[model samples]
Target: MRRIAGVFLAVASVLGAQPRKPIQDVRIDILSTMLTGNAGLGEWGFAAVVEADGRRILFDTGARPETVLRNAEELRIDLSGITDVILSHNHGDHTGGLLTLRRELGRRKQSAISKAYVGAGAFWQRSETSVLAAAKNAYESGGGTFTEVASAREIFPGAWLTGPVKRVHAEKNYGGTGKVRNAEGLWVEDNLPEDMSLVLETTKGLVVVAGCGHAGIVNILEQARREISKAPVHAAIGGWHLFAATDEHLDWTASKLKEFGVENFLGAHCTGIEAVYRIRQRAGLTRRTCATGAVGGGFTLKDGLRPGTLAK
Candidate 1:
């Protein structure tokens, strides 16, 4: 009887420890941006289409639905294929495309997207009523349902959200002046506690995609490292919000990211070109580590996440 129980326990353990499938490829297409290398589609916003593990995830939909839709048309990207949409924060550049995405979903007459992930404060009227209204209308008018992420959790086998990153570093500041309505029905300064990042686990490590690093890049990275695996981060793509940062801050950020084993830093939108350049010029970033993202360009990681020089 003891042996029988032991055997059953062993079988249960084996069944519980399912082997994780390796992600074959992770392709990220820059759908919209303020700085463009391909030209003709430049807009003051940020958006990208990420394809990984047979899942098409749209991260942040630029500043406006029209801009994103127009750019998507130019890039030949079908928004209908997006199975999930993740908004990093409640900022305009990130949430502006919600209405348009909803409209497009209506036009296609299909809800292919399993869900739209967002932080808890994503629907709050931080700056104005229009943004939150757009989000609500989009979701209610047959758009994919909005799943609010309050804590770190894996939405897919290899995909996750760094929900409400804990602020560890003292120097990291929440720089946005936006305001949100509090419980008392009075609008107050919004510290953007709902800022989050999308993390993808790959063979090499974690790839973090953020809308705007309002939670501070350092804090975001730390949360991602802790939530994902102990494996080193392969890349960090998106706005770092270092436009107003001082030289000391940029240097410190670069050093810390390197120490954390982040190899690639693709800065766009609010990252500030100068800050990215400084990061590239650092001691270890010689191999295509720093570059401004192009609007129509894409990045592909095949097989294991090996270190090959990424195309600039």
Candidate 2:
């Protein structure tokens, strides 16, 4: 009888150790612009904040923590209240602000928020091998915890960091250059990895917060559907990496997205102005342009969609 009781207790403990399902209320802050003052294109990055069952989770610190912090302050966002921080990839624009952010939180006397660095290990390789390596090292040295993502994991109830997206589509190469330094000094290239996105299950549908969509937007959407099993996509916001895409690629992507019935899209960063115009021309989809000063601009599952106010 005692053995039976012990066995039952052990089973209960095992079950208790399993992670609970995430609750869901997701919001993303477009902390900065990929295009700077001169309009030179840059890497895509944003800050994703999710409030699920009262817990606050931050995703992807932008290129400048100061910029993100300033926006947070203006929006009345309390960094001290954040519970978790998730970095989508290792690019400087995506993770440049983590150390500063940690310092800021420390200054406020708040315990360091738990952080999850989700991406392929490749992100930490050298720039000659991987363009995002430097930023990955910087983020790690800044007191952020790293979690290797193999499959979807719940960071909060109903909020998941979809693991590294698998490349399954034959999209155009859209060759472009990325800044890198080596024995020969700074250079550029067409090699970059397609990574994960933040997926939030809302009352209306799934809201996908992407980083760069290097994985192909269609692939990301299909994976999101696979993860949630037919959860209609309420909205998708983030860099779409469509700056150099051909007309056919853009058209095909738009067509595929329409078939999935995504309600809203807020494309920024690498999603070129041309792509934005084209997307807007498509019917039944609400589109918005996001940039640096628009940090506080975001959408809620309940609030529907809101664009950043145009700067004068």
lDDT scores of the candidates, listed in order: 0.74, 0.64
Per-residue lDDT tens digits for candidate 1, residues 1-312, read: 999998998998888765776566688877766676543376767788888877888888888767777777877778786668887877677778777776766577476543678787666655655464456754666646878898898887788888888778854555746678754667887767678888888876788888778888888888888776777888888777887788888889888888889877788778887887888776277545657776776566652221222335
User: Model 2: which ten-residue window has the lowest total lDDT?
Assistant: 35-44
Model 2 over residues 1-312: C-alpha lDDT tens digits?
999998998998888855544445555555565533222223345665656557777777777657667666666677776746777666666666677777787567455554655665434334343324544556456665667776777765677777877678966333445543322443434334426888887767778887667777888889889875477777878777887888777788878877887777777666777786676565245444222223456576666555555521
- Measured against the true structure, the TM-scores of the candidates, in listed sequence, are 0.87, 0.77
Indicate which candidate wins on lDDT.
Answer: 1
Q: Which runs in model 1 stand beyond 4 Å of their true positions?
A: 1-15, 112-114, 124-130, 171-174, 181-188, 303-311
Model 1 lDDT, residue 234, Cα = 82
Would you give me the overall lDDT of model 1?
Answer: 0.74
